[model samples]
Target: MTGIAAPGTKVAVTGAAGFIGSHLVEALLGRGCEVVGIDRRSLRSQTLARLHLGDVLDHPRFSWVEGDLTDLNLNEVVDGCMYVFHLAAVPGVRSSWTGFEDYIASNVVATERLLRACREAGTPKLVFASSSSVYGMVDTLSAENDVAMPVSPYGVTKLAGEQICLAYAKRPDSRLSVTALRYFTVYGPRQRPDMAIARILAAALTGEQYTIFGDGTERREFTYVDDVVEATIAAAGVDVPAAVINIGGGSSVSMIDVIGLAREVTGNPVPLTAVPAQPGDVRATAANLSMARLLLGYQPRTDLRTGMTRHAGWMRGLTPHLLRTYAPPPMITGPKEATCSH
Candidate 1:
């Protein structure tokens, strides 16, 4: 497959300050690409602090446009970009129950507007960061061909994202192509604080009780952050039709097993507690990476233990209190102050 990126290639990323987005930006810069990023968090704000973006925050090749995708000039983010990575959107299955409106605005409506912008800007490709939740509970491996019966509002919105991409790509006059990656339980250093791995590691650091929502046997295909980032870049580079592909580590393990890895990595195990499973929580997830391999030449290289060790080591550098006190940026719908460096 032909790849599009090269040194000095222009790229745009939404959710630039986020866990995966931050890592992607750093990787692109490492490849000598000039990157423009959009996120709701301000560079000067300490509220939504994440250590992942530290390396690229001041890199001359990186410029951040601050604000939600809906609030920003969509063309400004995607214009003249060879590839646009659309990773913006609120995440979490449980919270989707209560915050459905925010999911619609961020995940669905913002997506349509961004699609329009990409079409108008004539961007070659868009890589959307979708989720494994779109498959609901899968007894075996979740495939791109699986019936996407998303159990939560968040999943529904993500499926909406994939559909919207297909819809636009098929338009007779459209120039924008899209690749939607269904990431299966991405975990690594600076993972979103709400994710189980991050919360478990944080609890380990603080010696707090890490609660498991259900019996700890629920399993996930926890792809490493770096692996996810690699697949994302490949999606942008490989010349392929607009498609949905799974990005996973190919190793599925239980929550209890991950906790064991954390203990081995950190040498400090948090007290584990359990409760009945909540609504929309899946029993297990494993990704079918066949399409990723065939289409994007993707292969996941990180094992769970090694990935956990790297994650633990990265978190050890920061203050312990930062993990225990993370507040998600307020879900934005209306236009906020959109001024920033271009």
Candidate 2:
């Protein structure tokens, strides 16, 4: 029940077609593990077009189930699985302000249901993908002990999701050992088109203007996707009783600086359009990774310039039309100026 599930052991990953989930699925398959990838989007879905998992999907050790987490038959998915990595949740902070109910359903209610199902199925361990936004605007590098005061509904629901896992762990008869990883801003190739890095790179490549809210001073501890995947896999295998760990890139960079790095990396000067700061947006985020290192032996390998360079390369390989098709609508800056980037 502890230590990395042995090779050939079935592991279930929700959101398997997502940016991070797809990468995790590939890593698990490479480790000689049997994987069940559960995702709401099918292989044909436009959202998954960038995933590029033809070989992994064809592998004998990988199976996929497309269904909603809220109504999916968890018994069937969790049956005989050694570990469950729950990465399926509605994402985006700006969108959550108006779509709070969807966030609750996906992040909070679905998490509760998944935990209950894991308990019933006798699943031993679960690694939930929590967010660093749960810490809001921290004065120092955020730690697990800090009182969680999420400023946005997205962060609030992620905090609730973590609490649900902890609540289940506290049950007298429960066998589930939950490890919630509070991930800082995860970015790399295949990052959601809505994220800052993705949008910045796309704009740079396509000659489109990229919007920057908050005067380009906002900073984030941008963890690479591969690093997050490593920590997540380590968390699933480690014999931790029940813990919340911070998984971050270990370096904080300002938004304007990131754009400079992107220009240096891609050799494409990205046009910038600055707008008023959006609501629920924090000014800075830096993760205290002492716990992640101590607990999961996690250390981020990719630095900001290197990660951004890789992301730029990946974006360059994509068809121009796909980039335009998947580009997320401009983020809401404020009520006065509903939209900015075009």
Candidate 3:
């Protein structure tokens, strides 16, 4: 309650302990709104524990509800909230390869449940966290109305979530003014370590040999966490009708270039070992953000080089944790070394 205003609008943030969600919580607090944060995992370390505990320590206004959105009493949490940022889910394309049912439950079914609850509570607006993976290596850059061809179950679930939100919008009693922000390769501080650029760069910075899947040729637009968060906030503030906007970094760059940039920033000469491209991986993704520009006034400000520099700097600050997967450094030798080993 301390973070939320006494009489101010209440904003509920799902996945509050997550990278983007935590930052969004801080931003909402900065804006003088009361924040109700919910997350599924308990903190394993003191630092992370404080992220959830310190700001709202014994505060009357801030509320911490520890539960899963799929199982929670949604009405109890969202009852009076003016805005809801649905950021919770089992994330990662590789992750879905093993546990598709988890993705279905968390990303699809859970989202539907939340929408239903929003309808019941007469909630005004919701900002959904979606992925640009829905584009799936399209022949042209994805537009707002393109047929979403999700290559991965994870992407499928996210698209399904958006469709579910849209379906709810069509309902007579559905008062939820929802918007979906299709985020393109978000990176920055607190990035999930499994993500491509961050995970590899993190290992390289720390003198660990990181693995690169496939040749570092696939191009992607890596959006910074701040830019993505800003776009989400912009979507929340705007009156756009059932909008779906692309939030990418200003431009696209190849994985090879990103590796080079990370090496320049970290000054660490970690070795590289190329692996096969994981299933569900897209060759390239470029967002046609004209709709976002016209609707949310969202212009991705960070470029790949700047974003990687910032990401390397952030990873350098963290005390290295044991990464679940092994990573190799960027290969500068030749394109042959960088090609898929599989």
Candidate 4:
């Protein structure tokens, strides 16, 4: 948590109101660094309010900009900042199938604009929030150097964004240094309601049937959000000009097993209805953390059971009506349908 950046140094977080971004902003402020948060969500948006940032939202060290990354004045956002964590993107795989244009604008074009502004402002470091989706369906644990054969449009845009960062870093005159972290299945408190764990928890709490897109056998490396934030902060301190590293939980677990664990944690056995596998949905994803260890000394601390238990506990405290309200609409298959978190 310490040595994230110089104390009192200004840092900018693009998706400050998001689950992971909100955690990162809080951590940075706790470390005595000033944070400039940029998000398209209005101050009154439920997304921001539900985070319960409270004092952190009004902290003297925190300032928020209510605007999209595409239209924001990037130069001003990065001005006098030592680091920038680019986490803004139109997240979710299911929605990306029909919303490719929005994905490109948020993930690709917006990243290019930020990189250019960093180059112009001489920002020292930028940690891009890449995703394991970029690896698509891999035969074994995905490494940083593996071919980025992204299967989904969301994955494609994220890969392009990372490429843009590297392209800028390779410039002879560029002063900005970039580190892209391909996070695998990040989850914990404040997880988006649409994600697997959150949905499972909600079903357990409400006695509702949880929909499983595929059989419970699909596996994923569920990295905890706190561990991811640690890796991200560590990435900024590294000297790498341009490097891609995997930020994973150091292990993988089956979706069915996760459901069982949720039942044990929440003490509620929720019914599950399995559906056919959807397009662009990978059967498995695991990350090789060697590069992350070498570069950032990062190691995931939370196990799936422990993390899921915490998520269940957080959900138990929320009002039942609010849980239902946050749940995304039922999934229907079509060329436009897609799902999953980044």
Index of the highest-TM-score prediction: 4
TM-score of each: 0.92, 0.94, 0.88, 0.96
- Over 4 Å off, model 2: 1-5, 47-52, 326-331, 334-342
Task: Identify the leading candidate in terms of lDDT.
Answer: 4
Error of 1 at 229 (Å): 0.6
lDDT of 4: 0.84
Instruction: Please give the distance, in angstroms, between residue 76's alpha carbon in candidate 2 and its true position after superposition.
Output: 1.2
Error of 4 at 171 (Å): 0.4
Local distance difference test, each candidate = 0.81, 0.82, 0.74, 0.84
Model 2 scores a TM of: 0.94
Per-residue accuracy of model 3 over 241-302 as CA lDDT, tens digit each = 48788888767678777778877877875466777777777788778888878777777777
How many clashing pairs per prediction, in order?
Answer: 0, 0, 13, 2
- What CA RMSD would you report for each candidate? 5.6, 3.0, 5.2, 1.5
TM-score of 4: 0.96
Could you arrange the candidates by lDDT from highest to lowest? 4, 2, 1, 3
Instruction: Score residue 232 of candidate 2 by CA lDDT.
Output: 90
**Per-residue lDDT of model 1, residues 100-212, tens digit only:** 78889999999999999989988878899999989987799888998999887778999998899989988988777889999988888778776778777777877777767
- Per-residue lDDT tens digits for candidate 4, residues 1-342, read 333756898999988888898889988898889999888877686743445455587799998888888898999989999999999998887677886889999999999999989989989999999999999888799999888898888889999999999999999988889999898988888887777888888888887777888878999899989899888988888787899989999888889898899889989887777787787889999989999888888878998888888887877777767678445446565545435556
- What is the Å distance of residue 38 in model 4 from its true position? 0.5
